[model samples]
Target chain A: MIPAAFEYTRARSLADALKAAGTRGTKVIAGGQSLVPLLRFRLAQPSVVVDIGHLPQLQGIKRAKQGTVIGAATTYRDLLDSKLLHNTHPIIAETTAGIGDRQVRNRGTIGGGLAHADPASDMPAVVLALDAVLTLQSRRGKRSVPARKFFKGPFATAMKKDELLTEILLPFLPQGAGTAYESFEQAASGYALVGVAAVVAVSGGAVTHAAVGITGLADTPFFAASAAKLIGRTPNKEILRAAAAAAVEGVSANEDIHASAEYRLHLARVAVRKALTTAAGRAG
Target chain B: MTQTITLNVNGQALKAQAEPRTLLVHMLRDELNLTGTQVGCDTSQCGACTVLLDGRAVKSCSVLAVQAEGHKITTIEGLARDGTLHPVQQAFWEKHGLQCGFCTPGFVMTTVELLRDNPDPTEDEIRHALEGNVCRCTGYQNIVAAVRSAASALRGSRRPGAAVSGG
Candidate 1:
């Protein structure tokens, strides 16, 4: 099926993009990987397709004092090829490499992915684990929304209609920290059935701090706060299992053709447990 | 509603007036006559519509003509430069990477970008990277060979002249 007809506006720069996407009925098109396909399926219909792929300011990786800032428009292919992010945030780079495939990754942008806010997306869980901040820009102004507060619901984001996601500010994990992500991907859609991201900081064998994030099982990406509460002191086998269980507590898994809600919840528990183990082992 | 857009296909800039709803594949085949980029499924699931959108591979069927405005694109037609097959095209031909040949150009283009990003990729990495581009033929035995060979050729060409791979 073809996407419905729409007017096209190629934004020359950030200002032009903002003007073109001034709220109502305007859909910003960066990497049409998700949006265009949805359009073809009749999932979304927008009157204006604001093409921002040509905008220069929206692409590339940048280094900052706090951490690294990956431009929202930067493709997963860019992350895969980046030597800098590979060295520092290998989890980000590695997880991104597993996104879809060469062509999809090349065309899909991190910002577009986050803005699109697919519950099963690989980056959101990682960003939440990293405590990353998403910077949104609109004609009115710009605002930084922390990752934890970004998701409002499934396919729902904190972004206003007029705002465009421009930058993802990733905080550097403390030295000697370990981060990892594991996903159970649905073969057909390439979206995760259950995904987990664990970031751990180990200080002299005592877990100093940790963040456990889970996606796909819940309507929104969750921090697994209850599980994180069990890590700060000292994590043992029993605690890890208990935390994994807690990670799925109250999670409302999405059920459709790919997986049942109960099966997704089960995968969430397994994924979290495995991710926690992987993160712990990596840190050690 | 329809609109006109100029596209730079394989270094040759051409102008076409297509419906804003018309896909990049139709514009390439019907308007410009570069029918090499196949449309296997019409759905984005199949990568037969894959083409280089400014040096990166994307499903042409996933993008509209207007969406590709002011950007450079390379189709299967452009794979042969001045009557010489590109390294990727050559590798696919020599390695028997295709049987039906419906998915050849898409696989070739995707592999071109893959090796461009990673000169030498492991078999598992190659398999993972090619997930978006599907080829029913050869069961991927020859596709992997094609990518590995193309990688060596790409490296040889870029580094002030060097020897070819599997020579």
Candidate 2:
């Protein structure tokens, strides 16, 4: 399969990438795991592809007192190799490991995954639950976009054409907080049919805070505020099950060839229940 | 637009003229005539186009040649040296890991990375590592055995600093 002809420009630095993107009909290429496939299928025909895969400024994992900042270009392989991620935010490592196999993960980047906003991608739900912040920059200036508002819909984001997502800032969990990501993968495509990411903060035997993020069940990955009703209550099995059931309270399930809306709703409940239980257990 | 891109494949530098949209798999196979890497699925689902890009396995079909300009690439042809087969190739040959030999190169390259990362992977790990590569034949039993055997052999006979070519 041949992709549509386009001009390719490699950006040696962040400034160069932003400048290239400012041109009309230009798209930033990172990792190329998602965009290249789209290009091959003619689903996306950007006249100019700004390659930012080699930018050094956007290629490391750094943790400060505020939170962990992951360079947008950091590949899944880099995340897996980070001791800080494994120890501090192990859910990121666990979720990334479940993405497309070794080859895809080797070339896929966190920023690309989040920016692509694939409903079935593992990172969106996890990042949403983490309340991560995305840093967008351009030749004009820079601004921060919260994960909650970053994703507009499937394959759509709040980012502008001239801007580039340069970093993702994920806040560190408070003490007694634990997070887990669970997914039910569709065997053939290796994508999550239903995935849930839960963050539970327990204090003095009570659930102080609970955040539930769900994917592959709607037009976009979303937080389940209804599920967080467990706050100020003991998160027992029954309560956790109720929270899981409330996960898709106002959202409509996505129907596809692999699953019906009813079936996806069912799987969402199961995944949420499992994720919350595991997260609560880890919290203790 | 056509561009002359230089690729370091199998420890040798080769130059080819390719359009900005040219995939690395096409450059390796069509331009350089290194046909060991196959393209079973151009959409990146199948691992037949898998190769090492800077010491890691990536689907060549999914990466544009322009993106890989300055990176080191290692394909199946880069494994052997001086008429001696790589330990992985030897294991596959002895274990009948392949039935048609079409998917052999991809499996070999993927296994090279799996073993390098985890020298002694269990049966489940081997299966997980091979999730990207699809083999319609062999049911993957022999392929797992071949990877296990190759891991054992490499641990015993591998020469110091003799890494896979271009890796």
Q: Number of the top candidate by TM-score?
A: 2
Which CAPRI level is candidate 2? high
Highest-scoring model, lDDT: 2
In candidate 2, position A185 carries an lDDT of: 95
Clashes of each: 0, 0
TM-score of chain B of 2: 0.93
Per-prediction DockQ comes to 0.71, 0.85
Query: Which pairs clash (backbone N, Cα, C closer than 3 Å) in model 1?
Result: none
Give a tens-digit lDDT track for model 1, residues A87-169: 77888876887787777887788888888888888888998888899999999999999999998888899988888899998
Q: How would you encode candidate 2's per-residue C-alpha lDDT over B1-167 as one tens digit per residue?
A: 89999878898887889999999999999999999999897668889999999879999999999988978899998998888888999999999999998888999999999999998999999998898999988899999999999999887765677564322
lDDT of each: 0.82, 0.89
What's the residue-level lDDT of B81 in candidate 2? Answer: 86
* Residue B93 lDDT (model 2): 94
Model 1 lDDT at residue A266: 86
Q: Evaluated with DockQ, which candidate comes out highest?
A: 2
